[model samples]
Target: MVNDKLLQNLSRNLLKILDDDEYYDITIEVGNDPYVNIFRAHKVILYYRSPYLRRILSTNKKKDDKALIHHIKLPNILPEIFQIILSGTLL
Candidate 1:
């Protein structure tokens, strides 16, 4: 019982980082056309959470001398659906 609360607190604190946009290394653009929603996240945290994200980011990785922003655009997901997806990924 105590362990569960501790884990929940830890999870909430980590998820708060996403909300605060603290030390985010990557940006995700969900949807296209008329409108799009952008979300900032930590690359390392995302890589460990989802294999699909890990694979995509790996393939998209660029080799360059200068600093470049890591931007991922997903045209498939709608704004509302992406919110749900993001919620699930947090936990």
Candidate 2:
């Protein structure tokens, strides 16, 4: 089960990223099923299961564009992921 503290942190980070212009249209999903949490942006679809054990997956995108695929295993790592995504390093 996911920790409550972790979930709070993740939600905070996601909100911060949502304020950015570049990611304004980006979609954020959190769930158990990998298929359900997957998000599609333009021609790319970013998917993952969780933070630590999760494997980031993407399709129909170039290597450079794949940087947007940001998959966090836990809510605690949301801050880091948020920074990366905002910097355009991870999606």
The candidate scoring highest on lDDT is: 1
lDDT of each: 0.74, 0.43
Candidate with the greatest TM-score versus the true structure: 1
- Over 4 Å off in model 2, which ranges? 22-91
Estimate, for each residue in 1-91, the C-alpha lDDT of model 1 and write its tens digit: 5698899999999778766675777888988878788887777776776777789878877776254447889888776765655556432
TM-score of each: 0.68, 0.26
> Residue 86's C-alpha lDDT in candidate 2?
34
C-alpha RMSD of each candidate structure in angstroms: 3.8, 13.4
Q: Give the TM-score of candidate 2.
A: 0.26
**Model 2: how far residue 25 lies from native, Å:** 7.6
At residue 35, give the lDDT of candidate 2: 27
**What is the per-residue lDDT of model 2 for residues 1-91, given as tens digits with 9 covering 90 to 100?**
9999999999887656545446532444533444233332321212322242224433332466646544333333454354454344554
